[model samples]
Target: MSDVIVVGAGLAGLCCARELADHGLDVLVLERGDAPGGRLRTDEVNGFLLDRGFQVLLTAYPEARRALDYERLGLRPFYAGALVRHHGGFARVADPLRHPLGAARNLRAGPGSLVDKLRVARLRRRLSRASLNEVLEAPQVSMAEALRLEGFSREIVDGFFRPYLGGIFLDPALETSSRLFAYVFKLFAQGEAALPAAGMQAIPRQLAESLPKGAVRLAATVEAVDRGGVTLAGGERLEAGAVVVATDGPEAARLTGAVETPAARATTCMYFSAERSPLGEPILVLDGEGRGPVNDLCVPSDVAPSYAPPGAALISATILGIPPLDDDGLEAVVLEQLRRWFGAQVDGWRRLAVYRIPFALPAQPPAVLALPQRPVRLRDGLFVCGDHRDTASIQGAMVSGRRAAAALRGSDSGPSCAL
Candidate 1:
């Protein structure tokens, strides 16, 4: 029997197991898929490396300093500024450092009315100062209500939050709690949206390498867990001192019998290779006209030179709130939206890959804000970890995993670093 049997091979499970193993505890990781990455994955097609969707690695993630090697990973970055197209015109939303003076000029002279601009500036400052913990614990308020109370106009909400924030959470209704706003602002304020020179999968691959070889079991679907041990999909049973369930929220509930919560929203992404690329140097084109299922488009080659072929461009389209059953429809919608943006280029572009994630992001309602982290003890030998236990990002998953390890070690005397 192993000292610890960690269920799932995602970042959370990997991080938790790595920590425990580093402390000289025997750890085994079981994953249903052939790989370790949960959502941070990549696909190769025709010499092009494509992420499951357009995802940016945040350099400001708190867990990276301890859990990952950012410098060695070759995390190439894009221009922090994004080009936002609204109505009939487009404007450059510059980052603070990239074009500090220019950003000020645009913020002062851009499309918004005097009152609208002032309101946004004030709200931005307030959000920056507010602590997410305070908001999450105090009351469960919606973004719409918060914006209304702050006197933000409907136009500003639609033009900015609807497409931008919606793309983040995949919810067009904008019902996400304002508590998440702090995390979102942190990504922008730190100016750290980037992509690995290889692909997003490099992240999980790096973390997995920290463990002993043969520690992770790929395609080992877990069917049930008991105080004694865990049962595999084919009726194979293995014993362990403890089990850590590191799947997503719904899966965690299924394993531990916790209160049921809704599954995460899904995303639909499509990749196209163009002979003569219509996209420019900037990595992100936000809210471009007719960028429908394609709310945001990014040319990965702009950020990471190794992502595409020598002459071809890698164009990625991302849309939120896709149903698992609508794979074909998602692909068609993304392609149609691409056609609207680059009419002739769309014709010459070759379809590279299509990724439809049924559970791309957990639906973090206000109710979940109050939920404690996953129970580290299910009888004498069980635990759980995932983004649902904390924030629902790379940082959250890693943090949850590490916390689970600390709990299992269960004493300040046993390897202080392990905790």
Candidate 2:
């Protein structure tokens, strides 16, 4: 029997196991997949790396900075701002601080007016002055309402904020909590949005590698969990002194019967192979027109050349929610939109793969963000941790994991909740 049995070798589970093992506890991690990364898995196809979905690592995430080695990951940053498709053409909206000259040149040419640009700067300054906790603790409201209350013009709200923040929150309506919006905005202002040289999966893989050998067991599906231990799907039982449920929200709810299953946010990502880079720069392109299907597009090879073969470029298109179309139908519409953006050159891009993730993230609405950190200790000898228990980001997952470890060690003085 082990001191702790952590279910789901995702970011949360790996970090929890790492923390426990650091304190001399014998930790056992059980994962149902063939590998350690849960949703962060990457599949190599024809010398190209395709993540489970299009994802980016915010370099300023506090938990990630503590848990990951950015230098080892060989991080690559996207351009400070996005090229927005607006007014029947594309316009550049740059970060005023990062690209002062560009920001000045395009202040009158982009989606938002000069006043909107100033407002963005003002908002950035206001958020930067407040701490993360202060921002998260501020009054709760929908992102849409927050934008409106900030005195932003309707043009900027629809053209700039909708597509930009929509791609991040996966909420086209901007109904995500303003607390999350402010926190994300602050992060973006503070650091870069980047991808690892190997892929997003490198994140969890790094965490898992830091643990003791034989600590994690893949392909071990835990069908049931009690205070004593877990029973695998193959009818084998593994006993432990304590159990930590670190799976996604729904799975954690199913196994522990104590977690409240938060609603899921979905997304679809499509990859295309092209002979040459379209944008010729490592930058994000957003559909400021509020177009459907393709919300944002980027060339991964531009950001990190290793993402594709030497002679080719890897393009990723992100659709906020799962489209109801079959693969063929979806590809057709997506390409059609691309054709409009990049002209007839889109016809040369070959479809690589399509990933539809129904549970890309746990939905975080106003009510859900009410308590930034949920109680991780469910009962005596039982605990839970995942993005669902926190802010629904990589930072949330890691923080929740560490919190679970602290509670298990009896070092957490925070109030505990009953199962």
Candidate 3:
């Protein structure tokens, strides 16, 4: 019997287990996948490290930097600026601190009119100081509706938010809650976006290494988790003082008797190895047209050369929609987007890798105003954690897991049921 049993070796589960172990409590992590790092994973196929989708860390994500060791991972930084790709031409919005001249020049010449440009600057300043609690608790409002109230034109909204933040959560409808927009806006305003020299997987892998040996059990699918503890697919039951369900939102709900709703959005990422690099830096490039398979593209090799072989660039093309899990339906859409974004450059491009995560992010609509924060103490000794209980993101998952551990830590001091 373990002091604590955590289901799902994703970031949340792993982080929680680490915290519990550090507090002198023995923890065992059960993961359904063959390895840890659930959504934050990387696969090495055909001489390329394929991340599930193009994911970058915001330097401002409080939970991530505070919990993980960014220095040890050697993260490669991308520009604070954004490269907006329009129909005929493109414009690069340089970092205000690093390149004031570029910033001013783009402000004056960027696609948006003078009024819309001014509104953007004002909005940025306001978002910088916005509190997470306020945003989360405030009445639910859609991004589009909120922006319109803020006096932004359709052109500006379509040109900017649709392809940029849309690809991040894979929601182009822009119907996400205003709270999410505030949180995201703050993240973009305050910090630089960056990627690990190795890949996004490095962050989670580093966290896992900090734990004791045998702390995490991989490829151990969990069939059910009750008060008695967790029952594995193999019909093995493990007893524990407490348990944390740290899978994705839908899966977490199923395991913990929480809400099981269809995910808000799905992400499709295609990796193409091109001899010629698409853009100079690893800055995010958004398509202003707002209608296509290729909504955005991130050049990972530009940020970290080690990601690809010499002279070969890794182009990550992203599309936002809930496509079928099948390769024929999924790969076809991703490949079409690749050609649209890269043109003939992607023609005959080496098919390095492709990944489609169906329930990549919770469909955090207005209905999902807020999740239950209280730790679900279902059986005599069981608790649940994961993004399902909090907002959707790496930071949310980590924070949720930590909160679960805290609840169990308090319970341990109170009582222990004998079976």
Best-matching candidate per lDDT: 2
Worst 10 residues of 3 by lDDT: 410-419
Sort by lDDT, best first: what order? 2, 3, 1
* Shift of residue 152 alpha carbon in model 3, Å: 0.5
Better of 1 and 2 by lDDT: 2
What tens digits encode model 2's per-residue C-alpha lDDT throughout 1-419? 99999999999899889999999999999999999988898989999999989989999998898879999999999999999999789899898899999889898987777888899999999999998888888998999999999889999998989999888989988989999999999999999999999999999999998999999999999999997999999799999999999999999999988888888899999999999988999999999998768999999999999999999999999999998998899999999999888988889999999999999999899998888888888999999999898888888888888889989999854223210
Model 2: residues >4 Å from true position, as ranges? 413-419
* Candidate 2 lDDT trough over 10 residues, lowest sum: 410-419
Q: Identify the runs in model 3 with alpha carbons over 4 angstroms from their true place.
A: 260-262, 322-343, 371-379, 411-419
* Clashing residue pairs in candidate 2 (N, C-alpha, C atoms within 3 angstroms): none
Which candidate order results from sorting by TM-score in descending order?
A: 2, 3, 1
Per residue, candidate 3 scores C-alpha lDDT tens digits across 323-385 of 555655656666665566667776666666667667788777666755424344444577776
Against the true structure, candidate 3 reaches a TM-score of 0.92
**Which prediction has more favorable TM-score, 2 or 3?**
2
The best candidate in terms of TM-score = 2
Q: Ten consecutive residues with minimal summed lDDT in candidate 1?
A: 410-419
**Model 3 lDDT, full chain set:** 0.75
The TM-score, computed over Cα atoms with residue i paired to residue i, of candidate 1 is 0.90
